[model samples]
Target: MSTRHILLGLLAMGPRHGYDLKHRHDERFPQARPLAFGQVYTTLQRLVRDGLAEVEETGSDGGPERTMYRSTDAGARELADWAGSVTPSAPFVANEIFAKVVVAILSGGDPAAYLAAQRASHMQRMRELTAVKSAKDADLTTVLSADYALTHLNADLRWMTTTADRLATLTAEVEST
Candidate 1:
């Protein structure tokens, strides 16, 4: 995600200080992807360096002095363009267990145990996600999307298990050659 663009958009909503931006970001983050304070501040620095945000002094009496930020005209233009663009979805989906199983098999080690553990974990996660969907009072569109994502995850888990089984069998056969 373009944290810079996100920051710009947030600032465009109204003038905000770095602390306020971080607070807002933390509130908006999903449970699956939490935002860290460090990340929020780091992105703010980058935005300042890029001239996308300008610092200002607010006379509001809110305890200590706060350095407020306002999005520049250039920043607003960039934010609009970014929002309008339809970029392809990210491709690097991290499945650490799946990757580790592949590595163990390639290294001539037994991957059966790891693969089995991964299957159990993945299925458990799928069940949990399904339960969340059922237990929530979300809109129909959101529930449908969640169901689709859960199904995709389940399919990927099945594929990983099948691939691991084939690889283990093939490795055993190759060793006997």
Candidate 2:
């Protein structure tokens, strides 16, 4: 994920301190891995250094002083370009699961057993994500994120099933290599 671009986009909304940005990022992308505090500060600093953002203000209200950041005009332009651009879809399938399967076959390990375990794990995650998406209080953002994850997991599950069905052929090919 483009952490820098995301921070720039967030700053484009309004001035925000690191703490606020981090929390807002979490709220906006609940399915994403949570941003670390240090990561936020580091990314913010980089944005400032790159002239994509600047410190709008610094003040304290009976607490540690907070530096509020805002996106620069350049940052706004960059965010617009990034938002408008389309992400490439499956340009290459560099699948770790495929690699592991090949390795297991080559090493005389049980690829079928590994695939079974992986399928179980994927099913469990899909169940959890489904629950999150179907929760009574789930917001649009949360539901959308869960849906995105579920879609990917579903694809992975299909791939695993296909791979399992061809395991014997795959093993023969790997062994020949």
Candidate 3:
């Protein structure tokens, strides 16, 4: 989940301890899974190892030493590079379902049946995500996340129907190859 870039961005703000990084991450990424302390510390150690970050200070004031970390120049460059990169609109070139359909047609199986099954699955997932989005007590972030999932599932449902309709043609094309 680009944890390295996330941590580097946080460090760019200012020096922070592992605990602070966790807190900031939680607040910033409400829709994301919570970061565990072990993960945070492990990623931080890797950042240090890679010369992307450094321990700025270590507090030992009669308590557990809190190591404050800051991003190095290299970390800033990495963050900028990630930020500038443009992901394609439809980046499902390696989609497993597409592969399955091709394989089914190649093996003389029913790609239409596979598409039907996939449509059913996508519909069920959309129903589940719709429930989450429509919950009375759901927060904005949670609702947004559910909505995003629903949109993708809806697109998949459309693709399933379209593919099923053209399965015969697809099978012919595959047979020709």
Q: Which ten residues in a row have the lowest lDDT in candidate 3?
A: 87-96
> What would the per-residue lDDT of candidate 1 be over residues 35-148, giving only the tens digit for each residue?
576887788777778888887766658686667888988889999999999998868766776688768868977688777777888788888777766875765544675687
Poorest stretch of ten by lDDT in candidate 1: 26-35
Global CA lDDT computed for model 1: 0.77
Candidate 2: segments with Cα more than 4 A from true spot: 168-177
Question: Higher-TM-score candidate among 2 and 3?
Answer: 2
RMSD of 2: 3.7
lDDT of model 3 at position 81: 93
Residue 113, model 1: lDDT of 74
**Clashing pairs for predicted structure model 1, backbone only:** none
Give per-model CA RMSD: 4.5, 3.7, 4.6
Best by lDDT: 2
Give the TM-score ranking, best first: 2, 3, 1
lDDT of 3: 0.87
Tell me how many residue pairs clash in candidate 2: 0
Stronger candidate by lDDT (1 vs 3): 3
- Candidate 3 at 53: error in angstroms? 3.5
